[model samples]
Target: MGHFVIPVTGKPVDYVAQIFPKNNLIDHGVIVENAEVYRQANSDKIKVYG
Candidate 1:
């Protein structure tokens, strides 16, 4: 959503999205169904999408 820059040895370069970034993710349903567990949340914004 935003542009970023990364510093190399010489100069800073534009940051690009990586295809194989290390991440921890889970099923969307688990998040939606257990939304209440997020104590500090905007309940109105939580939604389930197909």
Candidate 2:
């Protein structure tokens, strides 16, 4: 799980955001923005999950 601090426009509240497992998977495991997009963009190299 990843944690992020988001700053609001005016409020003094501490807004936080959590990136889900699927979203975190991208650019991390495969270094791709999106699986399908990456696949369509790159056909020469096959996408494999580690």
- lDDT by residue for model 2 over 1-50, one digit each (tens)? 67442222222111112222435432222223332222222133534334
TM-score per candidate: 0.16, 0.17
Best by lDDT: 2
Range of the 10 consecutive residues with the lowest summed lDDT in candidate 2: 11-20
Clash pairs detected, candidate 2: none
lDDT of 1 at 6: 23
User: Candidate 1: global Cα-lDDT?
Assistant: 0.23
Writing each residue's lDDT as its tens digit, candidate 1 over 1-50 gives: 34323212221111211211323222121132223221112222334334
- lDDT, residue 36, model 2: 27
Model 1 lDDT, residue 33, Cα:
28
Go through the candidates in order and give the C-alpha RMSD of each one to the true structure.
16.6, 14.7
lDDT of each: 0.23, 0.27
